[model samples]
Target: MDINTICVHGSAHKTDYTGSVTVPIYQTATFAHLGVGQSTGYDYSRLQNPTREQLENVVAALEHGTDAIAFSTGMAAISAVMELFEAGDHIVISDDLYGGSHRLFHHISEKNGLTFTAVNTTDLLLIEKNIQPQSKAIFIETPSNPMMQITDIAEVAKIAKAHRLLLIVDNTFLSPYFQNPIDLGADIVMHSGTKYLGGHNDTLAGFAVTASNELSEKLRFIFKTVGACLSPFDSYLLIRGIKTLSIRMERQQENALKLAGWLAQHPKIKAVYYAGLPTHHGYEISKRQARGFGSMISFETDSEQTAHQVLERVKLILFAESLGGVETLITYPMLQTHADIPASEREAKGINERLLRLSVGLEASDDIIADLEQALR
Candidate 1:
């Protein structure tokens, strides 16, 4: 089926209950067994739920993967994948990663003995050089947070295959509508469903899709054992959100492109980091890998004072930490999202004090642009 059709009807069907067009939420905690050791597909809510299963199937289809597992939050999904590795295993990750991910690798996981090297994964040579004998996985986020750095998924996957390393991509920014990393040869694709997958700020969820059965089993084991499964209610919301994903993303991307172009020409803007902009360093590579340049963009001002001024002045866009909702959101990476990272590391990665990140929404392009224009002035 085409993507549009898949969005509306994928992994869901009318049930006998009401013959409703939407999938009915199976809200029960546990399913009754027919007899001893004989049961329906589900046993307990924590292990699986009908609503969550529908969402998993939809996300798996969208990502072009064999299976998907939904989680309570994006961090929970990341932690589940990370659990596949042993204490001594090393990971090579993109330098300009999401701040929460950086905290997970640098602080939380470090105490458990998992070491990581933050490198520019866009440069395969640097990534290859940093891989150690114990390197088990290549973790990356393309069109990276704040910086919008694009990584070559295919190239990185090839390197991972040759070196026997797992390749995991955080596909939160581009979402499945814009990019499918599994098709590009990634072993696993994960998302902060709180963002694009949910399409609204109403729910918190995360998911991971795997390309191979072997990897799927590993992830499933970790997911079940760790028990961070997403709630049935949020799963229902996520499925509904995905139905309008393509259309919402189209408008958001349009607004983002226009805004990026305008910001580039503005005198106060020192740099605009958006793949849609021709001058952006990642524009060419991003175009090759993604179906569309995503709605997320970041820019830097001359001073931190000016950055705060812009955020305070912007009336239409909300000031918040999360992204990929129907409403536009603006955040300061240095203070809001990337605050956990050390000042020295953030500065080195160009996540400077003057940088402001925007998750463009499905608003009128002209209105959004006008709001930004007024705020900048």
Candidate 2:
């Protein structure tokens, strides 16, 4: 079936109860046993839930994966995957990553004995040089966090395969509608379903889908044991959010392109980082890999004070930490999202205080552009 059809009806079928067109929320925490040692498909909410199962299957099918596991938050899903690595194992990651991801790898994972090296994965040579003998996996976020940097998934996958390393790609920015990393040979594809997958700020969820059954089984075990499963109520909201993902993303992409173009021409703007822009370093690769350029955009202002001024002045866009919702959001990565990282390190990576990131929404492009124009003024 086409992606559009799958979006609306992939994992759900007309149920006998009320014959509702929409999938009804299965709110029970546990299911009763049919007989002694016999049971229904769901034993407990943490292990499984009908509503969450529908969401899992939908994401799995959408991403072309063998199976999918949903989590309470994006960080939880990431932690579960990282747990597969042993104490001595090393991880190679993109330098421009989500702030929370950096914290998890540099602080939390380090405490657990898992070492990591942050490198520019856009350059395969840099990645190859940094791979240690004990390196177990490579974690990457293409069109990375605030930088809009892109890495060739197929190229990285080839290098990972040669080194017998697992390849995990965070598909949050592009979402399943724009990019399917599994199709490009990535072993695992992950998303902060709180963002694009949920399509609203109402719920928080995360998910991981694996192309191979072996990897799926391993992740499933970790997820079940760790108990980071998403709740049934949020699962219902996520599924509903996904139904209009294509439409919402279309508007968002349109708005983002227009905004990036405008920012690039602005006098106060030093640089605009967006895959949609012709001059963006990642434009070609993003064009080749993704169905669209995506809604996230970032720009460097003349000064930190100016950046904050622009954010404060924008009336239509909310100044918030999260992204990929129907309403636009603006954030300072240096302070809001990546604040956990050391100042020197963040500055070195160009996550400066003068940088502003925007998650464009489904609002009118003209209104968004006008609001930004006045804010910049």
Candidate 3:
């Protein structure tokens, strides 16, 4: 089936006794068993819920994974994956990743005895050189947060296989409509479903989609044990959001391409980091691995003063954190998203005060650009 059809009807499970088109939210803490031993496959909400299961199934289908585990937020999903590694295990990860992920691995995971080596995953040699004898997995976020650096998934997967390590790809930026890391040899795919998968800023959700049953089983055990599963209502919200994923992604990318092009030509804008732009460093790699460049655009302004001016002055384009929604948001990553990182390190990655990240929404391109035009002036 086409991705559009899948997005709309993928969650239609066999247990849908109701004639309604949408998946009904099984809003319950526990389900009564047919008998003491017999079960309806869902005994508890924490272990599983009908609605969340439907969500998991649809996401699994989209990512071409064996199964997907939904969580309260993207961070929860990542935390569950971290539990898969034992003490003394090391992981190779992308350097320019989300601040929250960096904080978790550095503060929490390291405390638990796991170590991480952060490198620019875009360069295969940099990744390979940093791998340690204790390395158990390689984690990467292609089109990494704020910076928008693209890593070749197929090439990275080959490196992981050669080293006998697991390959985990964070597919939050591009979403399944644009990229399927599993198809490119990722052992596991991660999503902060709070972003594109939800398609709206109203709800929070996350997912860990596994390529094999073994990984699915492992993550499921950790997920249920941690008890951070998504609520039935949020699952329904995500389901509703995902129904329009195809159309929203299409329109959002359309708007992003236009905005990126305009920003590149503007004198106040120093550089535009959007894969859709042929001049972007990651253009060819993104083109080969993903269907579209996605709706994220990060641009550097002429100075910190200009960056602040645009944030304060834009009317239609909101000055806010978070992305992958129906409303265009312009965020200052240095203070908002990646603030936890040390000053020197954050600035080194180009997420300084002069940088702004834009989450292009499903709006008329002219209106968004016009708002920026007025703001820049």
- Per-model TM-score, in order, reads 0.98, 0.98, 0.99
Cα lDDT tens digits, model 2, 241-289, are: 9999888888899889888888888999998999999898888898888
Q: Would you list the C-alpha lDDT of every candidate in the order shown?
A: 0.91, 0.91, 0.94
Which has the higher TM-score value, candidate number 1 or candidate number 3? 3
* Stretches of candidate 2 exceeding 4 Å from the true structure: 12-17
Which portions of model 3 miss their true places by more than 4 Å? none
What's model 1's lDDT at 214?
Answer: 93
Tens digits of per-residue lDDT, candidate 3, 59-171, equal 99999999999999999999999999999999999999999999999999999999999998999999989999999999999899989999999999999999999999999
Q: CA lDDT of 265 in candidate 1? A: 89
Among all windows of ten consecutive residues in candidate 3, which has the lowest summed lDDT? 11-20
Task: Tell me the spans in candidate 1 whose CA falls farther than 4 Å from its real position.
Answer: 12-18
Q: Tell me how many clashing residue pairs each candidate has.
A: 0, 0, 0
